[model samples]
Target: MDEFAFVDRSKTNAEKYVLRQKLFGTEEVMPLWVADMDIATPECVLEAITKRLAHPIVGYEIMSDSAYEAQIEWFATHHDFVMKREWLSYSPSVVASIGCAIRAFSDAEDEVIVMDPVYPPFYSQVRENNRTLVIHTLNQDEEGIYRFDLDRLSTQTSEKTKVLLLCSPHNPVGRVWSYEELSALCRWCEERGIVIISDEIHCDLVYAPHKHISTARIIPENTVMLLGPGKTFNMAGFSISTVCIPSQLLRDKFEIERKRVHWGDGAVLSHIGFEAAYREGRGWYYKLIAHLSQNAEYIDKTLSSTPIQYAKPEATYLAWLDCRALGMDDRELRKFFVKEARLGLSPGLSFGKEGSGFMRLNFAVTSQTLTEALEKLRGALQGDAYV
Candidate 1:
């Protein structure tokens, strides 16, 4: 496979590429802030969508049983997770499912505990629903690896706490929660009657020597697992995801909430694309991982001698860069990157207070693009012209 199959996404209404001026106050900087990749969507996915387009009329369509089966088989084969056909529910997006779960399972003013410095939506969904947003900050060791602050998490939980939104193979920090850590978290949540909404969107993007354990595999009865191909297959435009609920009672409540919002079924093309990506995307998926791993290695090797410090991510293409060594506050760090480096990156403070002095870089671009970005960064740091 040509790992450098770069697709110019500019002028196509791509949120990452087209919204630079609105998002970062300039269109000159490289856009690497969004989670999607700069690589082309797999041929298999495009082919599937093309096949579906052959139909004369694109009308209201229901999700096929085969779509659910494809997802079930993929999870069972890849993650050792056995999902029942009945356990699957269609969601427009993971965050949408999370919002529905929040409304269905908890009442207004109830508390929902989110691991701080998490995906930003975890914060917004809780507050938007009129629920009490309780943040339990994650702890980092001296080595810069992030870990669940289970001790503090336990202290934060109470009868008012109704949900725990978990990010496995977490975003930005990129810590694939270990099985032991997950087991402990499951026990803690189960004991307190807390429902766990585990977002495993990046489960398949894991690197070697660090495995991703599905939270549902450990504690299915108490967990609502959100799995999707958006991150793995770069299909976020499809706006389709699956919610796996093991307990029938919880599924029932979620269904009611979903209906309350009049969330209809997915588009016909999305269904075709979803099933094809899961069924025929394994080969492309592995090759993409290899490319990403190489990109990550390049970043690690290049940054080793610099003042910038980063914890090499075990999963996801996102790298968390610790810039405190540069002695810049969060604002200065952002300004330095945008002005000096001409690189657009996600500011660490957006994740949480703990993320201050850090930045998240998405490396899922062509090797040439990544090298150029890194060279620009290196030049800025060394007070030389960026090439």
Candidate 2:
């Protein structure tokens, strides 16, 4: 394995080990569970944060016009989508924004639709707000690719459905939804007056041959999109997210909630990080995606040598490994890796009921780290977990 390819080693070492110890009770196990990248934030982002650290005070911050401008420019340059500054609102985190949207836009009894084996936060945000949580399970063909069953979704959604929490360039499974699929879903929601709250936080991490389309770009004005640099730049600890609302009515309602709750603002350092990443991190982002693609391919090749099997991920750094052939429940299998192999991974059951017999791995670390993890996994598979 190439040493330089393991960029995340120096930067993510401390957090990575702490997570490993927490999950598997030792630093000996390589952690590939968290969504955070093992790589350092770009040099530009690092410099900006350091420069801010030099200043003594960390005071209350109002988002600079330059910060907002950086966001607008990023979307236009990379995504080819344009937005006015007025459409943007700041939130501390996208998950928080999701809960707020559920409360402010939809009534208590209204249903919010999401795909199963989705980000776990989506499940909590819906149910915690007293809204009905409805899941639309994606169908998997013999090829192992997960595809949305629109007919099934159509049957599930009704006039009482008030929102759809969509994940584009979807999480865990890593599908950058096709234009046709997005358009059909958008039209269905638009016709029903059901608002679309797209958690497109993972929009920038799409792999080759896959394109991420903003659902609002294809649908009506009722769509609200959540985007941020936290995931793209590996700056989740900074805690900043942008909520994009196209409709004035919906925007006003969100503002009313914002005022009542007194949501916190992004840190000054976080603002600097965001500006630097959006303005100068484009090349770094491209290289990072290339590295991730190689890692995903590595997982594919490694799995073929063992009893484990998985379909290639088209987007995101996550690989969804189908461990059904091992004939163990997700919980038991996850335990086998932790106790037997000393490997930590995100269990499929955490995503949803449909995720049983599956495991999600994050290959965003260095090639060297992935190799060790895979070797350990190979050793684990030889145990009763396989039989």
Candidate 1 TM-score, true structure as reference:
0.98
Model 2 ranges off by over 4 Å = 1-28, 383-387
Alpha carbon deviation, residue 68, candidate 1 (Å): 1.0
lDDT of 2 by residue, 307-363 (tens): 788877888888898889888876679778787777778888889988888888888
Tell me the TM-score of each prediction against the true structure: 0.98, 0.93
Go through the candidates in order and give each one's C-alpha lDDT. 0.90, 0.83
* Positional deviation of residue 235's Cα in model 2 after best superposition, in angstroms: 0.7
lDDT of 2 at 74: 91
lDDT of 1 by residue, 189-263 (tens): 898999999999999999998999999889888889998999999999999999999999889888999999887
